[model samples]
Every structure is written in C-alpha cells, then in structure tokens.
Target: MDITVAEALVRCLEQEKVEIVFGYPGGAILPVYDALNHTSIRHILVRHEQGAAHAADGYARVTGKVGVCMATSGPGATNLVTGIANAYMDSIPMIIITGQVATSQVGTDAFQEVDITGITLPITKHNFLVKDPAKLPVIVKKAFLIAATGRPGPVLIDLPKDIAQARIKFKYPKTVELTGYKPTYRGHPSMVQQAAGLIMSSERPVIYAGGGVRISNAAPELLQLAETISAPVTHTLMGLGCFPGNHPLFLGMLGLHGTRYANQAVTECDCLIAVGARFDDRVVTKVSGFAPSAKIIHIDIDPAEIGKNVRINLPIVGDVKNVLGAILPLLKKKENGAWVARVQQLKKDYALRYDRGGMLKPQYVLEKLNEFKDDDAIVVTDVGQHQMWAALYMRFKEPRSFLSSGGLGAMGFCLPAAVGAKLGAPHRTVIVVIGDGGIQMTMQELGTAAEQKLPLKIFVLNNQRLGMVRQLQEFYCEKRYFGVDFQFNLDFTALGRLYGMEGYTVETEEQLLEILPRVLTSPEGVIVNCIVDPEENVYPMVLNGSPINEAID
Candidate 1:
C-alpha cells in the first residue's frame, strides 16, 4: 500500500516487532516524529539526543533486540556520537535515525544540517543516507537485521526532510542481501567435534562467558553444556546477568577487578571453553601468562574476534547458543571432581570482601539497593566505582535483569538507560545507580524521564569527584587529583528540579532509609542524591600488568 517514507520507516520497524524507540524531536526531524504518533511503536522522548542514544543502547543490551534512536541534524546528531561509539565498542545492536536538510539544501550547510552518515561511518556496522522515499522500507529492514545479527553494532540512517515527507509504496523484504554482512550460524563440523573431544578428554574445564552470551541469548544452552559436564563458569563484567550470580557453578566476575579465585581458576584450567567471550586484555593480564597450559576453544558470532586477542586451538564461527547446542550432546559427562573441588577451594580462599567504614560506601549503597529490588526489577548503571560495586553486590537471578556499558565503560550511561529500561519493562521498577561524575555527564536524561512521566528511581552517588580516575591516580599517578576532583560542585538536586523531577539529598544512612522509600512510593520520577566520601575507591582492583594477588586493597 502507498505510504509516506516516515510511515514506511515505522512500518518496517513494527514489522520487525520493535516495541519501543528512544529519541528527541527537532525541526528537521518533525516529519518522522509526526508520523510516530500514527504508529503503535512506543517512543521514549529523552532529555537529550545523547540520552536517547544511550537509552536505545541499554534497551538493546537487555532485550537482545535492535534498539532504535532518533534525532535531528547537526548538534542533535553530533550529541549521539558518544552513545553510538559506546555501542560500537560494546558491539550493541542499534539503529540510529537522524534528520538531515532537504535534498536541495544538502552540502550547503543549511541550518541544523550535518553529514551524520559520514560522521558515524567508522563507528557503525554500516550507514545509509536515504535520499529516495522508496528505499525507506528496505533500508530500515536492512538496518535492523545488520544491527542485531552477527557482531552486533550501531547503524545510522540519515533521512532528508523532503524524503521523510515523500510518498512511497511500503514493502518490507523477507531477506536482506549484503555481500559484507554474511554471518555464520553453524560451526564447522570438524571444529565442533574437536572442541567436544577436547572437553571430554580434559582433566579440568572452565567456560568463560561474556556479553555476547547475553546478546545471543545463549545462557540456557551454555548452562546446559556446563551442567552436562559439570564444568565451572567464569564471567566477564558484561556477562554478569547471563548466568545466575548465585549459582554454584558460577565463579563470579573475572577481569581487572575480578575475584582472585575467578582469575586463578581460569589460569589453572586444563581446558578453556571460551563461549561468546573474547579474551580481552583486562581479563587476561599477561597474554603469554594467561591459561598457558590450557587448550582454548573459542566460540563466537564474529570470526575475527576468535583469534583477535588470544590464539584459539579450536575455533567455532557461529552464534554461541547454536554452537553450544550442537556440542552439548556430544560432550562426555566426565566426573572431574578434583578440578571442581580445587575451584571451590580457591573460591573459599579468596572470596570477595569489602571493609565496612564510617562513611557511606558505594558498596553499601549497592547492597542496600539490592534489598529493595524485586527479582524482576531492572537495574542500569554507568561506568566507574558504582558499576563495579553493583556488579559485585547485586545478585542477578535472571538474564537481562542488569544493563550497563560493560564493553565501552561509558561514564554517563545510567540516567537515560534507566528511561529505556523503564520503557522496555514498563511494569518492573527501573533503577539507575550512577556516580556523581557520571550523573552530571548526561544529566539531561532527567528531563526525558519527566517528560515521559517515567517512574524511575535514580540514585546518584555524590562523591564530588571522578572516583575511578581518582583511584587510577592513586595507584598510577601517585594520588595526583588533577582534573579528577569536582571542586565546583553541581547541585544535583537543583539539576533534577530543572528537569522537573522530584529531587532529595541523603547524607546519612537514616536519611537514605527514610527518603528512598518515600521516593519509590511516589508515582512521578525521583532522584535521590546520596552524598558519599569523595576519597572512596573500589578496592581489590588488579593493577595493570599485575597478577590477581597484586590487587589494590
């Protein structure tokens, strides 16, 4: 049937079963926004364009769908760069739409005009500039497919104002044809068999999980394979929610700040079944020293990632879920009791611990936040001390329960992410745990929450400094707090008020106890600014190029 290009865009998205999109409106993008009102797809109006992009990213990370965001040209599109690049680094699946000047005004530097496609090219999986109204359906369909399939990442689509208003016949293609976009879903039979043989015959085995597991929804299959052979599971920071944190087989987080046991367990394993996880530098301190004796079997959706960082003895180029499913039945149910015992012993020896102090600690805030959270509540976080604390303190029971910028480690991720999480899981409570530095970076998302009437509980851990950088300075820069301390304090309460959200500051534990309940009870959005010690740092951090035992206390 005949439809406007803007309608066709929405139609294509709807056909893909996209339930929600995050965006901000502008003059150039008014056509798309106008068309949005006619579609069933839920639009989350973010406070800033950057927030919209991050909100889309958070939604995609949790739901395993191609999250979508929109913005106008020039500054609006430029603002999305950080979020888009953040998605690019983390391999998130997202489709970012931006408005451009009319076809006649292209390249003339018209008001609010920018070459968004050109700017985002390197950061995206692929990009398109739609000058033709007829290409809307195919481009939208292609964008979603490319963003979600294989090594997922952000894709940009720039639409000229005239194009969005132009009429077109809507037709969603059943299949996409892109020569460079081919993704392998089946592992080479020989490689799969080799991996299975290695696992069955090995004396010790460990499954290393990452964000890819969650992205590919391979948790069930991964668990099945681990249980089939009774192997232990170690997770990367991004992999936190993929496996139940409380599960006995789970070895908790492993990385720069990973537990000593988790690090040593992988190091000592005879066979490493790396599923949906690349051996990032953070996880493997010294590449030559990491799992030196273990035979590596790498299964990933992206073939390039298999040997990018670490050499793989057996490489399976396919989705983690599909590969694991194929090899599960072939795996021998061997009784490696000694190996399991050793892992458990190591875990007991080096369990995660934090010293309780007089001042309010980020870890304490996280532990207490856990108390108020339901099994279904969605928690989003930005990078820094708070993110790690949430990872360490929060026990995620279900997949997709946690969302954060694990790969990119974006500082200003939580606020708008909370908005997206709320939209994705409307009935569930969406909480954003962010540090003071992170909150201020993308504080505009508060306006998004207020405009949309999203009832999100935002906890800003106000330390008045860049906590992570300060910690880095302590260890690496000899405690030089250059550009790390926020001497010119930003009143978060006033900022929240500017965004039209109720704001409260808590200085004491009693204040937190007294105010958080009141904040949550309210139907409108609220920001609880918790004052924390500026000097506080996340402890047990493994120094760069050092062993797990060399962790900063």
Candidate 2:
C-alpha cells in the first residue's frame, strides 16, 4: 500500500515504540506536523527549539533510549546545536529530525532554510539528508540504531518539504542492514586478560569511572569487579550515580573541581583502570603528568578514543557492559583491603564539607531538596558551580535519576532538560538546579514548561556573577574579577509571573526553611531564586593545566 512519506516516517517511529517527542513547528515542517496529528505519539511543543533538543537529551538519559526531537530548518535547527553538542560530548543517544525547504529551494536560502546536515556533521555520530521519499524508513531506522548502539551520540535526519509530501510504500523494517554502521560490541579477549593481569600484579590499583558506565548500564558489573579486586573507585563528572556516593570503596569525583581526596588517590595509584571514560583535560590537568607512576589500562567502545588523549598501556576496545562482563570472569580473585582502607582514610581527612555562612548555599538547597523528595525524583543541572553543587550534594539512589551536561558542560541545559525529563517520567519530580548566568541563557523555556503544564521545579542560584570563572580568577588571576562580574539584576519573581510560574526568592537560610516546603508541596511547578555568596569558590579545585593533586582550596 502506498502512503505519504510523512505517514511512513511516523509509522516507523511508532514501530520503534517512541512514546514521547519534543518539537517546534515551522513553515517548512507543516506536512510533518499534519502527519503528527494522525499519530498517537505524544508531542511536546516547546517554546524554543533549544528546549526541544535538551528535553530529548533529558528523556534519553532517564529512559536509556534514543531521544527523539524535531525542528524546522535555519534558525530552528541551529538553535538545537548547543543541545546536540551537549548530548554528543556526553555520549547520549539522540535522534534529531529537522524539516528543510523544498528540494529546489535548498541552496537558494529560501525563507527559514539552513544546511543543518553540514552544520552538525562533526558533532553527530552519523547523519542523513533525505531528498528521496523512498529512503525515509531506512534512514530513520539506521539513525536510531546508530544512536542507541555502542558509544552513543546524536544522529540528524534532514527531510525536504517535497519529500515529506511525496507518496511512497510504507514498510517499517524490524532490522536495519547498514554496511557502514556496525558498532564494536565485543572486547578483544587478549586485551581484557592483559588488563586483568595488571590488576592482579599491582599493589595500589584504582578504577576511574566515567559516563560510559551509565551509558552502557555497567554499574552493577563495575561494582562487582571493584568489590572482587578490592580496588578504590574514582569518578569523573559524568560518572556519578554509577557507584553509590557514600560507598566506602568510592573515592568521590576527580577533575578541575574534583574533591582533594579523589584527586590525590588518582595521582598516587600505581595502576589505573580507566573504564568507559575519556581522559579529557578537565579530568587530567597535565596530560603527560597525569598518572605518571601508574600503568593505564583503557577500555572503551570506540577505538579512536583509546589513545587520543592519555597513552594507554593496555587498550580494550568494545562495549563497556560487554568488556566489563568479559573481564570479570578472567580477573584473579584477590583482596587488597589495605589499599581500599588507605583511600577511605584519605577521604575522611579531606572530606567535602562547608559551613552555611549566613547565606543560602546551593549545597544546603540540594540537601534539603533530597530530604523533601523521594528517590524516584529526577535531578538536572546546567554546568558551573551549581552543577558541582548538585553532584556533591544530591544523592542518586537509582541509576538514571540524574541528568546533566557532563562532558560539554553546557551552561543552559537544566531548564530545557527538565522539560524533556518531565515528559519521560511524568509522575516523578523533575528539578532543575542552575546558576543565574546559565538560567538566563535559556530562561525562555519557562514558557514551554508553563504551556505544557510540566511539573518541573527550577532552582536558580542568583549569585549576580559567574561563580566558577570568578573562582578561577581568584586563584589564578590574583583575585582579579575582570569580566566575570555580571551586574544584571533579574527579578525571578517578576520573570516567573511573566511566564505564568510560581516563583520565590530566599535570601537567608531561614527563608529557605520556610519556603522550600511550600514549593515542594505545590502541585504546579515552582521556582526558587536562591541567593548565594558570589565570592565563594568550589573548593579543592585543580588549577588549570596542573596535576589533580596540585590544587588550591
């Protein structure tokens, strides 16, 4: 039976069991929008295209699926760039569908037309431009398959208006056969054995976990291996929630804003097992000097990332879940309790603790939030001081309860991400913690939240400055504030009212104590404008370009 390409596209998505979609309609996308009304898939209309993309990311992070988002060409597609790049850096699975101008008007720069395929080439794992209606099903199927497979990333499909309107036979293939798209799933047995051998021989061993553990759902395997070998575990920004934060075997996060004890443990270990993580500069300040005394065993799904940054003594290329599964059986079962004890002592000595200096601290805010909410609630954050605060303070009891822009560290991720997260899990409490600067970047999403009636709680840390940059300037620039001072005075209450949201600002700890409870109980989403100390810095920060241990508090 012949059908419109638009019908085939929606049918394919339905076949794949896509329940939620985030998108914005436009002139070039009218045909697809028309088809959208015929499908049972729930569509969220975001106020801005960027919100749609971030919402998709949030959904994918929580559900462990390829998040789907749609937008029109030109400015609409370009707006999604930040969110797509954010997902790419974090290895999140995302499938983006954008509507382009008619085939004849592509290069002529027709109204609301842009070359999104070219713009997103480097960032996406793979992309396709569907000028032919017959290719729609194959391209979409392949795109989702590529996005959700090993070493996940975003995939884009640009459909011309003519193609969407054209008629074609609809056949949703259950399996896709793409010669150029096979992902590495099994680890080399020899390489896995070599890594196990190193673990057996080393006196002081540590496992540095990253976002890959969560992406591959290898947290259980990782915990089991760490327990069997008695090795201390340290995490990158994205590695949180993979291991329990309060676990004695877990040595908190490591990086520019990493805890002092975690950094010291990484620097002092004799052998390092890097699992599902890239040695980005943020984590390894001095690339050459990082783990100078340790033999590095790198395991990842993508072969290109094996030695791209830090040199690996043993490299295992495969899916993290698969690699960890294979290596567990080969590992020589032994206990190194002394090494684990040593890390525990380090953590106790240099524990992350802060005093509530009369002002409402972001840490206190997160803690109180936890006290009020359940484990099923989802937490999202934008990058900066607030991001670190959420990581350090928020306790994620479940695997997929936390979402943020870990790799890209994008500023305006929280608000839009919460929109998607709420759509994915409507019954769960979705909270967004963002710095003032980051919040302002995409504050327009408040309109989307209001319109969709998504119960998303947003906490804005109104410090009146870029707190993270100011921290850097204070340590490295001899306390020179420079361009870091942001004087924009935004009235959160007024802004929330403008977007038809309930807003409250807490300047003192007592105010927080009184207002937070009320907001938590409110059925409609609420906003907390938390006033914090602008001069405060994220402690135990590894100075830029220096080793993790060389940090200034």
Candidate 3:
C-alpha cells in the first residue's frame, strides 16, 4: 500500500514504539501533523517549540526512551536549539523532527525556510535532510538508533514539505547499519585488572560518578564497587540520584557549590576512580590542584573525554556498567577504617548549613520539601540558586529521580520539563523547583500542563532577583548589583490561577508549613509561590582559580 511520506513517518514512529510526541504545528509541518491526527501516539501541543523540545527531553530522562519532538521551519525550528543543546550536553536521548521548505525551494529562502540541519550540526549526534521520500523510514530508524545507543544524545531529521507530501510504499527498516559508528561496550581485561589492583592497593580512594552512571544503568554495580572497597563516593551534579543520597559512604556532590567534605575527600584521596564523568572545569575547579594526591582512573564510553580535560593515569574506554562489572570481581574487600573515619569526620564538620531563624530561605524550603515529599518523587529543577539548594537538600534513592539542565544550565527548564515528566511517569509524583527568573522564561508552559490536566506540584522560589548571578557579582564585582534584581516581580500564585490551577503564596516558615501539606496532597495541579530571601546565596562556593576543597561559605 502506498502512503504519503508523512503517513510513512507516523508508521515509522509506531514501529519504534513511540508512545508520545511533544510538538507544535506550523505551515511547513502541516501534512505530518494531519497524518498524526489518525495515530494512537499521544501528541502534546506545546505553546512554543522550545517547550516541545524540553518536554521531550524530560520524558526521555524519566522513561529511558528516545523522546520525540517536532516543529516547523524557520523560527519554529530555530526555537528548538536551546533544548536540543541541553539534551546534547546532558547526554539525553532525543529525536528532533523539523519541517523544512519544499525541496524545490531549498536555498531559495522560501517562506518559513531555514537550514535547521546546518545550524544544529555541532549539537547533534547525527542529523539528516530528507530530500528523498523513500528514505524517510530509514532515516527515522537510523535517528532512533543513533540517539538511544551508547553515550546517547540528540539526533535530528529535517523533512522538506514536498518530501512529506510525496507518496511511497511504506517499509520501516528493522535494523540500522551505520559504518564508523560502533560504540565500545566492554573494557579490556588487562585494564580492568589494573584498575582493580589500584583499588586494592590504595588506602584512601574515592569514586567520582557522573551522569553516565544513570545513562548506563550502572548504579547497582557502582554501589557494589563502593561497598566492596569501602570507598567514599562523590557525585557530579548530573550524577545525584545514581547512588542513594542517604548512604553512609555517599559524599554529597563534589566541586562548585559542592559539599565541602566531598571536595576535601577528593583532594586527599590516593586513587580517584572516575566512572562515566568528564572532568569539567566546574567539577575540577583548578585542574592543577584537583585530586593532586590521586592517581586518576577514567572509565567512559566516549574515549575523547578520557584525557580531554584532566590527565588520566589509566583510561578504560567502555560502557560504565560493563567496565565496573569487570573491575568488581578482580578486587578483594577492604577495611579502610582510618580513611572511612576521616570521611565521616569531614561529613560532620562541613555539612551544608543555612540560617533557619531568619526570613524565608530557599534551603529551608527545599529541606522541608524533602521531608514532605514521597521518597520516589521526581524533582526537576531549572538552573540557579534554587537548583543548587534542591541538589543539596533533596534525598533521591533511585536513578532518573533528579533531572536538571546540568551541562547547559539552561533556565526556564523546570515547568515544561515537569509537564513532560508527569506525562512520562504519570504514576509517580513530579515536582518543579525553579527560580522567579527561570519560571518567567517558560511560565507559558503552564497552559500546556493545565490542558493535559497534569497534577504537577510546582514551587517557585521567588527571590525577585537573578540570584545566582547576583551572588557572583557580590563575590567578584564589589557588589555593584547591576541588572540582576527584578524591580517588579509577578505574583506567581495569581498567574497559576489564570491557568485554572490552585495557587498559594508563602512568605514565612509558618505559612510554608501550613501550605506545603495541602498542596503536596492535592489531586489537582497547584503552584506555591515561595517568597525566599533575596540575599541568601548557595554556599561552599569555590572561588575562581582555587581548588574545590578551598570553598567559602
């Protein structure tokens, strides 16, 4: 049976078992949207193309699938850039479909035409411009395969208007074959043995885990490795929920805005086993001083990242889970009692602290939120002080429970992401913690949530300032305090009401305590506008050029 290329595209999505697609319609993409009307795959209509991309990103993170998002040409396709970059930076698997101008109009700059594939080249794992209608199914198959494979990232497919309208006999490819793109899954036995020997020999060792742990589903293996060797574990921001936050051996997040103790442990450890983590500048503070005493062993699927930032004493290029599994058995159990005692002492001495007696603080709100929410609740945050506070305060016991814009640090991520997360994991509670500035960036997404009737518990930490940048100014610019403060802050609770959701504003601990329980247990969506102190800043911050351990509160 011959079908329009647009129909064939839908069939390809069905073949891939795609349950939901987040998108916005426009003229260039009309045929695909029309064909989608006949499918069982749920299509979430977002107000903006960026929201659609972020929604798909959130869905992918929570569900461990290739999230799909679509948009039309020109501004519509360009608007998806930030979200695509966010997914690329975090290693999230996503398929971005964009509609281009007709094939004949290529290079003519026809109405609503743009070179989306060219613009997204550096940010995507792979991308295709579909000029041939017969190749749409194969392109989609390859896109999915590339996006969801080892060291996952976003892949794009740009369908010209004419290509979508063209007729083709539908045949979704069952397998994909792409040359020069094989991913290594198994570590060499000799390298694994050497890593085990190093682990067995070192008296003070620390496991530095990152987002790859979650991507590779290596948390169980990581936990076993840490326990068997009795090594303290410190995580990168993207790695928060990969290990149980409450575990005794868990040193909280390490590096900028990291726990002082986690940073200190890394500084003093004799061996640093970096699993699936790139040594980003934020995490490595001053590379010369970072893990100065440790011999570094890096395990990652991407070989380019092994020695790209920090010098690695040993590099094991393979899947995190596979590498850790191989290294686990070659090691003997250790009782590094003195090192364990030292780490425990550090944890106690440098525990996160904030003033609780003063006016509302973001940290206090997050601590209380942690106490009130279910252990399995999914917490998604936009970047800023509120994001750091959430990372420091929340306790996550499972992978994918904590989602944030880690690498890109994109603002305006929380609301739309929460919408996608709730849709992806409807059975689980989804919460959004974002700052006033970030919420305003994508607050329009509230309409999408309302239409979907998603019961998302949103908390806007209303600081009335770009809090993170304001803190930076205080530290580096003699407190000039330029351009960061919001002279007129929106009433978030009132804004929620406009979207047909209940809303509340809390300015004090008493008010917060009063409102938290009710809002948390509510069956309908609700937003709590938390008026946090503007002067409060995320602490244990590493000063520029200083080692991670030498942080100031």
Residue 397, model 1: Cα distance from true site in angstroms = 1.2
* CA RMSD (A), model 1: 2.2
Clashing pairs in 3: none
The CA lDDT of each predicted structure is: 0.84, 0.86, 0.93
**Which model scores highest in TM-score?**
3
RMSD of each: 2.2, 1.8, 0.8
> Residue 331 error for model 3, in Å?
1.6
Residue 277 accuracy (lDDT) in model 2: 92
Tens digits of lDDT, candidate 1, 365-468: 78888877777778898899888878878888777888888767888888888877787777888888888888878877777777777888888988888888
Mind giving the per-residue lDDT tens digits that candidate 3 earns over 399-477?
A: 8999999999999888888889999999899989999999999988999999999988999999899999999999999
* Evaluation by TM-score, superior candidate among 1 and 2: 2
Per-residue alpha-carbon lDDT of candidate 2 for residues 1-553, written as tens digits (9 for 90 to 100): 8988988889988988999889999977778889989678989888889889998999999888889999988898999999899999999899999999999998997898899999999989988999889889988989898998878999999999999999999887778788776678889888888888898898889899988899889999999888888888888878888887667787878877788888888888999999999998888988876888999999888999999999889999988989999989987777777777788889888888888776677778878887776667788888898888777767765567888898778888889888888877888888888888888888888888888888678888888888888877887789988887776678887787777778888888788889877787688778788888776667777766788888776
Candidate 1: global Cα-lDDT?
A: 0.84
Worst 10 contiguous positions by lDDT, candidate 2: 390-399
Candidate 3 stretches with Cα past 4 Å from truth are: none
